[model samples]
Target: MLLQMKKKVLFILISVSFYCGLSQSREVDSLKLSLTNSKIHDTIKIKNCLILAGKYGGFSLDSLKKYTLDAIDLSKKNNDYLLDGGYYFMGVYYSEIGEINKAKESYKKALPLVDSISNKKKFGQILSAYANLLSETNELDEKIAYYTRALKIMESIGDQSKIAFTQYNISNVYRLTGVDTLAIDYLQRALISAEASGQKSLKGHILNNLTIFALKNKDLEKANTYLIESENICKETKLNLLCFHTFLQKGRYLDELKKTLEAENAFLTALKNAKKRGAPQDIMLAYTYLGKHYEEAGHAKKAIQNFEKAQEQDPANAERIMSPFSYMSWSRAERELGNYKKSNEYLLKHVKIMDSLNSEKNKKSLAIAEAKYQTVKKDKEIANQQLELKDKASEIQKKKTQNNYMLGTIVFLTIASILLVFLFKQRQKRKNQELLTLKREFQIKTLESLIEGEEKERFRIAKELHDGVNGDLSAIKYKLSSLLEMNNKVIKEAITMIDDSCKQVRAISHNLVPPSLEKFDLVEAADAYCANLNELNPSIEITFQHLGDVVDMSKKAEVNSFRIIQELVTNSLKHADASNINVQISNRNNLIQMTIEDDGKGFDKTNIESSGIGLSNVQSRIDYLQATVDLISNEAGTSYTIEINKETLNGN
Candidate 1:
């Protein structure tokens, strides 16, 4: 309620509102013209489509989606490299339209593409945009991590505009999370960058944010200074959307300064601008803030009326354009007006949303953890039942034979004939048992060969993708860069696609045959894997330790053992909800030992041997190495200990 008075995240609010004015700009017309020209290169058309889509920002989401899709289709048809922006913009559209989950997917699709591209600006924008997703609120660390990464990229590229916004984003997160000191510190840094960038709308937004921070710190004088400056900037720039937000903050600052009539006018102005801008979120916030202004002024009936208008804008969870503060304030207004039922309803909604935001939901972390728990239980139960059924059937068959033998013994006239028949039956049973054993061994050998062949094929494909296809793509990118105008953003964009393709190819190739395993020994590979995993998941820490030095196993054995450790560690990360994981290995004489442990709420181990629950492949690798594993899991954590005898593997 304190720092959160920054109130409601409207990420669709374009920082520099002239971008909003782009809808009517001649540039949009020019881009559209190029897109329709038959003589234009398909690559140029695709770039135009993306630019046109961006130009549609703050104007028509449908047009944005249309152009983005067009770009994606044309890129795929032309085998062009322009796809990340398509996905990124699609993510933005999804987020704006309240498809949070789909937005996340789109963001993920774009994230892997941005890593190899040379445009650090887009990289920063993508990260900053994704961090604004509502689903990211609970992942505090990851949210900051994204902003931090974006900030670094912006700094590297020396893009003051991007840097300012990134700093502002980081500040907003801190403000919402209640680190007021750090929030204000970063906000000040953002103001400096905004000044350096000399963008009026950007400067306005930063000053308005500072006004909120200043008011929160009870510095009315500072708040007054920022509010006035922000208002002047927004008015001068004719930024309607920016005016709505800046005016809203000005209203709050005036309210804090106890300027009743002035505060009322500011709120009304914000509402008028929001209507003109035609964004539901802006309208909703304006109404909510006006309602709060009236409520604090003791106009209970008027407060309820404005609150109702805000609720109308929302339309049964159609959008979350108002903050918990708005809801709570509305609830209080209802209570003051003697509407107990409405008051409680609003209050409950406020509390529920707050709880969800405060929860520790790190993207897919919670779902993976719960799914693993249930899956492991279901698999184990099924496996145990199958084993029991087999045992019962075996017992029944043994009883049937014993009964028949007793009856034959009783009917036998000579004891010697009974003895000869029993002996012959025993000899036949031994031969059958031998045949079954041989069949089982043959099946295991066949499986081993299949797995070995699969690995070899994977290695071959990895080499081809990395050395052949990837290399060729890189060469083309270099050639294009040399031939095209260096100042052309379109060429940079095409290079973006090539870079994305090259990265995608390398990723697939790595998955087929992990470069770490091929390039290093098991110990070094384990360390590299841990490092990579840690990088992928900023929410979790994975540590690797190797102790002792001894001999090397056969290649097959070493690989299988490496895989076992890999599988165990990855499983812990995905399913254990572990904050900390440790992988330790020791080799002495001919014995090698490994222990993978995690500080997570460990799963039930009942009937663990019955079903694999996706651990079947892990078990197969373990079996191949002739290794023994001891698995212990409890509330404290899960630990996997494995031992391998190098001599035994080498001899085999």
Candidate 2:
């Protein structure tokens, strides 16, 4: 069971990895198709369908707004419990481009959807995105709650990559709440999953988060390690935006280590790269870091100059223009300069911004509450509508029930007819098989009888030639020899002719049936055959190797073996055009094995069975002895192995 589970897991991993390896353009289309197919007129499909619609619509702000509204309309048209989830996506899209209120409003809309979502995976993604937005804006508790919900869903589905992302976001929530140890723990888990999955983008994202966590914990060594990893993965993947961000992190790590010169260089590099990319958030982040670095180096003028530059570049509604770190730096710088009024002014401005950010979050909470109330009210109305729908559904069901009985009767009759036909087919197949078996048996018997008769007739003729013809010629030779001593040239010529005729008759008989096998042994007969085969084809080489005991089998066995070998050697010479042929005979454990291997113009195994009769004849002989023959042929050569059971040996 454990092994089976491992196999299943490996299969799943391969499938997921294959999909993940597709290019971004392919993934978009695949995801779109998946989303389209997911629509089932049920709440789950409706939720996913709207999410997909919103995603496609989010190519630009104008398109995003248009698509998001369309999604909202669809969600309402479906009037699903998961309707709020679409609003969350809208909020995220709006917030991304600095529309905080719009973002909050959309997030509020998503809350009701989350409440009614039947699908865990869909709800989890929604919660995760919303949680991330909340964490970024400093709603720590709310962020943690949503992340937990998302993480649970991810765990359920075994989606390790998304689970890692959710954990990383959760860690950020912990970091926001000043829980550094827990944050580190979660981030480490996130890192493991990310690396295991080869999710380079997610890994870089997690590493960047880990860098911030390490910096917060004052673990400069740990911070640098993660920063280097993040930078390398980002650069290798050409994640330019991520690479741009990692520079600022590296600068912070250097500053933490008190390498002021190196830190300044890092900060400058980060600013230049971020400016080149024209990423406003990254540029603001770089300036924030550079300001702190300059302030720590005791360059108050440069510190103030960098801080003011960051504020100017920050978008008009940027809530966190003076980052928490920047505010700390600004406060210290003002106090050091003895400008009490300016110090208080900066402090007051920071407090005001923080207050406004908090107020925006509160407004979000109230909006969510209002949305929830509207959702509940809508749910009640839907419930009443469902009650009416149920009555209509009952009427439809009554009609369907009557239709079902008729359909079932037809189906039953159809199934019975199919069963009858199947049984008849089975009966016919059995009859056909029996007829085939009988025909094959009759064919085999007739062929065997013919072969036996032909072999017996050839043996008789060979005996006649060897005995009668050779004896008569020898007698004529002796008579001629006696007369040739008296200058009888005609007689001598006649004797010579008769002697040649006698020799020709002996050769003919030997060719008809191997003579050595009757007089000598298997090896001698094989040697003589090889010698004659080589004579016929001088270009072909034949090697014979015999091992272990050799037994002289019955005439029938010998004749069959000789015939098979003769055919094999003939075919090799005529068609194989082989350079070398090796015949190996081995007797081991009371079994006889013959192997014929040739370096020839080899044939393809696929084509061999259909191509000619040589293989068919070989197979037939092996089948007669209930032995096995395996022919392995390829482009390089051919190998044939025939194994006969020792127990079945005719003369054992």
Candidate 3:
């Protein structure tokens, strides 16, 4: 029974995660459409392309690579100097797909151009990417060097976010190299930087890594503290990715502490969150860990199931992200279950992966050795060049002494030219700002016009349904009633059916644009709807209460507020599975406040997709009304409070 409960919880987690991914996919689609339809600057287009590429990288390598190359081409065509940024993305794509050699080449291509870029932020970013590539390939010394360089640049620019990120990467390298002391030191530095930056996401990530280090050292108290802190940050910020990693770390810590049931729940939660982010690497890790847990618990069948799932979800670069132990564990489970052939197959796959890893390690070692040799050779060449320069210095000194006055005059003119250029650039910047502001105003007006048109269309549709379709249904019902005088059995049944059909048509018409809303006010309409809902679904109780005198508002405001309430009620019925619900509205001091509470299993707010269309519809209405909505949810129940100012409603 306990195992069944665990499985159920795990399933819920995965479902929630999958829904979140779908929501994100929809957002990505909208962004793509906007990019395609809009006539933006080439630089903005390039940025959007890169953003899309990063979004797709988790699921589609081909798309990632295509967008990355497109960005590079666009940058070159526009002379944007974003070529280094493009190459950095290319490196990231290659690394993610397990093309180590290609990743290395891309990083090398990006490194030299970093210094030429005008954006210090991009320069720091590229340096960090190069460092990450080095770390991935086990070039520890080079990784540390590049990370340090990136950190210095970030510090010089006073970018605390980048400093924290660089420090985190350096700590990861140290941890991978088994330099525990150095890892802990860098992690502490990262924490300080992250705190100073005031970025919840970065702080959460650093805390999660610190928790892992604490777990590795068997410092249970420290691990728990860090995990709790990280989880809190994730919850507060809705950083699903960080939350997923923290859950995974917590599971491991619990497993070590011998709390098997709690550990199982933690792993399942991790799996759920990973699925939400739709990151293949994270999903694969969660599956691998769960499989291991099940195997250790002597559930061979369950273990095999999870292992198969992990394999199915594994990305093209699975060999890089997946642990060899996953394969070994699967083989063991299969063998134990008396599936010798399958066991052997898994064992062979594990062997192949191990061999490939070994080969890659050897290549990396050789590359490092070659790099060292090249560095020494370059040093010697530099020494030779310095000696030659020294030899020519005496002759150059005599010439310099003769042209000193002329050189000074040239320097002064150069300074004056630079000042003129600076002044001209400043004037151009102001003009550009003006243009940008105008563009923004135009976009805002366009959006508002579109929204207004949408509402007008909805009103037209509602009128048509009510006056046209409902009128036809009413005419038919009246005709049927006249025929009911025949008193035949078929005629009586037909009349009853016609009566039922008429009622349904009227109900549909009312739903489109509630008669109470048009004739009365929002509070009365909501109360009537809630009463009807209670009659229809006696299994679930609903109550509506209103306080104070309701103020008059515009037709649009009334319609939107009613629709928002209707959507919330519909959502509760379909998804909340609550047996009881309460709604209250209060009007005072030129403000209207509405609160809805339900006794149902609360959902993960981080997984926005799980909220579905009903919540989205509610949001749209609230946005139209310019109202404020606040939600509080937990496993026990969910509540929402919305406030609308009467002045705002009047203005609308």
Candidate 4:
């Protein structure tokens, strides 16, 4: 009942794009986890986006687009080179959804960015992708040529997985041109490549093609084996597109074995999965295969129904996804049912589409265009390499000429060069010394402000304890003594304890908020403090003297100045074992100078670091006052001459 069955056999049913690998859902989850929640737009995030864009495929086009656009935006933001990857993935997405024209445009944008095929695997994949687009308009020769180029790159790199994809595409083209022997041979080669690739999902797709070829050969046993193996792989990997084809192929196998009911059931299963896949091509394939099934069974009305459904797919997918066989089968069905007019109409339409697709003149033009494109690319590479070689020769010649002419000049400049380097080093050394001095000055200013605040806080706290809590302790002690009997031994001991506590508090308060330093100025304070120290320690004769006109200074300078003199004198009594210490203070031109001479054993200046906190405390106060000390120490005595520039005090 079929008209011209051998001549009207349409091209292969499956049009597989370049499937690099199966990107698992968990991998997508892992990449999303690596991305921070705060949305820092940086290079690290952009790289994650590019990798994630490549990771999304199959049915998750939405996520693929999301990360692709994210990568593009972030690459532009960071001035990076990842926009090419975005365009490449966009082409894949467009092609998958049956947007042939948009996919072509995206591939064109990506072509210039990819490196040469030998250097970058992405270049070969992009080439294969552009070739896939060529298949839509029946540019079969151009498609095969591009796939051959990509195949050579894959083979050179030993990427069996990529080799399998290219082989499968090339075989499909051979099948389209009705070269059955070569098509079958190429499919066998592709099968070997897929098995060597060891990608289980890819092997499954290749096996599906093998199942179709075996069925066409009417080798029922081979077809059964291939069908079972591929079906298992499809189910295991959950490759939706491959699974749909495997199911349709199984229906054909079942029909060959005369299991009519099971064969129809398999076709319906394919239809269900096709609808869920949401690709118009897969849906059309499912319906067309089902229609072919009923046509072979002599069910004219049922075949016509399925064929009509196949033609009613999305118009956007009409050019790329529609099959020529649907109209041919519909014409055959109408002719068998006494509808000559409708039959003629359907047959004419099918002939027109088939002629357009298999036109020899169009194929020649496309082949020439493809040849020109390849030639230009090769010519450009050759030109660039030649230019580089010519530039290198010129550069070498220029260098030789310069060396010959400047031989004497080079000898003359050597001595001058040495002198210039010596002077440069000297200048650098001077600059470094100046930097250290500036750093020291800044450090002194910071410590002066901080230590000055600390001193004031201590004075305030000492005053609070001396004026408030000491008064309360005396009042309590007196009240307790008056209310208790004086003759009781317990009462006497309690009062004695209270007296001891009060004395301790007063001693601490007096040491912190010293009476001389709190109430008198620096000169008066120094004289009074030394006189009180001599009274307290009668064995030591410590004298204090002052000279020069008093200069106005801030409270910080006054407090710190007195503290420095006090600390130096105290150090002589504690560590110096000084029996006779004399301290003198003089002021002139906003500069105050102090001299402390002790008749005690002087300490090693190197060992000053190991001395107690006494000298360090003095040094801190010295920095606060913007002062320096010159020490002349020996076994007989130690003398400190400290000078303070009152004008240098800041935030005093």
**Local distance difference test, candidate 1:** 0.75
The RMSD (Cα, Å) of candidate 4 is: 18.3
TM-score on alpha carbons, each prediction: 0.49, 0.45, 0.48, 0.50
Better-scoring candidate (lDDT), 2 or 4: 4
For model 1 the TM-score comes to: 0.49
Inter-residue clash pairs, candidate 3: 13-272, 17-276
Specify the poorest-scoring 10-residue window by lDDT in model 4. Answer: 1-10
Q: Sorted by TM-score, highest first, which candidate order results?
A: 4, 1, 3, 2
Task: Please give, for residues 1-652, the per-residue lDDT of candidate 4 as tens digits.
Answer: 0111111111111112232233333365656776665665566666667666654454445666787788778778876566677787777667666566998898899889767844546677777768866752356557777888988988888888778777777766656555668877887888888888676665666676777778878898998888888888877867565577778889989999878889999999888877765656667777887887888789989998887787687655453445567778788999989899999987887787788667844675566577669889999999999998997899999998899779868876987899899999999999999999899888887787677677778778788887888888888878878867657777677778888777667655665657766676878877877877776788999998888897456766777777777778878988888789999998888778899999998888877867662487778887767679999888899999998876676544
Please name the candidate that would achieve the greatest lDDT relative to the true structure: 1
Clashes of each: 1, 2, 2, 0
Q: Listing every candidate in turn, what is its Cα RMSD in Å to the true structure after a full C-alpha superposition?
A: 33.9, 14.6, 24.7, 18.3
In TM-score terms, which candidate is top? 4
lDDT of 1 by residue, 290-374 (tens): 8899999999888889988987976876224467877888889899978899899999988976876566333335543554587
Task: Kindly list the per-residue Cα lDDT of model 2 for residues 383-429, writing each as its tens digit.
Answer: 99999899899999999999999999999999999999999999999
lDDT value for candidate 2?
0.66
- Angstrom error of the Cα, residue 267, model 2: value is 1.9
For model 2, what is the error of residue 291's alpha carbon versus the real structure, in angstroms, after optimal superposition? 3.0
lDDT-superior candidate, 1 or 4:
1
Candidates arranged by lDDT, highest first: 1, 3, 4, 2
